[model samples]
Target chain A: DVKVTQSSRYLVKRTGEKVFLECVQDMDHENMFWYRQDPGLGLRLIYFSYDVKMKEKGDIPEGYSVSREKKERFSLILESASTNQTSMYLCASSFRESPLHFGNGTRLTVT
Target chain B: AQSVAQPEDQVNVAEGNPLTVKCTYSVSGNPYLFWYVQYPNRGLQFLLKYITGDNLVKGSYGFEAEFNKSQTSFHLKKPSALVSDSALYFCAVTPLFKAAGNKLTFGGGTRVLVKP
Candidate 1:
């Protein structure tokens, strides 16, 4: 079983502050993704990395960035946290041809 | 680009009753379909996927999905509903959606509420 772990279950940040959400996968899967879930907007992809040092912008990548310095870890960075950015963030990893294995998720609140 | 849609925002069902959640998708080529369930505050869980062999695929938790190419739909179904089955359901598509061979596209999602 693949275990995708997010560093925090809940986080609160002050507006305009920078926030970092970390994720690590036990399985050395090459693909890692960050997504935000909102009430009516389902899941919107933020960023994804297919390999260390490689990253791709997803549908909604503005105000966000990502890092993949190590194969097992992927990090999402919010340059400046805003109340509009508060939402449940999910981390997932997957191998080619397989389904994504997800972490429980981190609920970030920007106050 | 590939896209998925869950027509209904919510589906209500009674325990022991058949449960169905509708899903439809559009893709550039052959579609690889998927169903996922998300419990409150949890990440989405893979339910079942339709590749090719059979139009119907069975997955964890006694859940199954049937693929209808003509209708461009893949609907999730269960013979019996349990209170625990209540959750948010999402449908996805890939080539782009597959294992993320590319980008994965998802539907808006449908919330299932099983009443006693």
Candidate 2:
């Protein structure tokens, strides 16, 4: 079984603070994705990286950025956290035409 | 652009009974549809996907989904509902023409409850 590890399960941050959420996968999958899960909106893609040092903006990437310094690791950075940014963030990895394997997720709370 | 829709917000069913969750979608070209389930406090788990070939796709945990191209629907089904089957379900889709890194568009999600 593939294991995708998230650095934090729960996080609390104050407004205007910078937040970094880290994810690492063991399968060496080339495609990594970051999504924010909300009550009614389901999961919305925030950012994704297809290779190290390569990233693409998703539908809702206004306040977020991503870094893929290593093939196994992808990090999501919130430049300035706000109350509206409080949500569960998910990390997923997949190979070409394969189903995505996801990490448990990190719940962020910005107050 | 591609879009997925799960019409029902919640579906209540009894154990041992048939379970079905409805989904519809729209996309520019061919659709790559998928179904996922999320246990509480957990990330979404891939249930099944319809890429090509047979319309009926069987997936993990005894879950199956049928792809209907004419209706633009991909509905998930289970022969018998188990209490453990209770979870939040989401239907997702991506355009076939896109590259490998294509991101999926998800529905609002449907919560399933199986009673004893």
Candidate 3:
């Protein structure tokens, strides 16, 4: 079975604070993704990494950045968090054309 | 651009009753469609996918989806509903030609409520 782990399940931060959400996958998948889920909006992609040091912006990538220094780990960074950034963040990893395996998700609260 | 739509926001059904959750999609070229289920406070779990071949694809936990090219729909169905089957369901689509990376566009999700 594939396992995707998120560093934090829940987090709270003040406005303008820098926040990091870490994800690690044991399956050695080549593609990792970050998404935010909001009520009524579903899940919207924030960023994705296809390989180490290679990142691509998703539908809503504003105020967010990603790091893929290693194949097993992917991190989502909020350079300066805002209240609007508060939401459930999900991390997923997958091989080409394969179904994504997802972490439990990190619910971020930016006050 | 690829997109998926879940028409119903919520679906309520009694246990042992047949259930259907609607999903439709639009994309350039062939469509690679998928259905996922999310329990409370859990990440989305892959339920079924329609890559090609059989129009009716069976998946995990007794769930299945039928792909209709004419209608551009991939609706999920089950013979009988169980209270445990209640969850938030999502439909997603990725263009087949763009298979380099698995970039999927998801629907808003439908909350299924099964009453015992």
Q: How much is the lDDT of residue B35 in candidate 1? A: 90
True contacts kept of each: 0.57, 0.60, 0.72
DockQ of each: 0.65, 0.70, 0.82
Candidate 2 — what's its lDDT? 0.94
Flag regions of model 3 displaced more than 4 Å: none
Please give me the DockQ of candidate 2 compared with the native complex: 0.70
Q: What is the TM-score of chain A in candidate 1?
A: 0.98
Q: Sort the candidates on TM-score, descending order.
A: 3, 2, 1
TM-score of chain A of each: 0.98, 0.99, 0.98
Question: Model 1, retained fraction of real contacts?
Answer: 0.57
- Candidate 2 fnat reads 0.60
TM-score of each: 0.96, 0.98, 0.99
What's the C-alpha lDDT at position A58 in model 3? 100
Model 3 B-chain TM: 0.98
TM-score of chain B of each: 0.94, 0.97, 0.98
Q: Write the per-residue lDDT of candidate 1 for residues A1-111, one digit (tens) a residue.
A: 889999999999999999999999999899999999988778888999889999999999999999999999999999999999999999999987688898999999999
Q: Any residue pairs clashing in model 3, and if so which? A: none
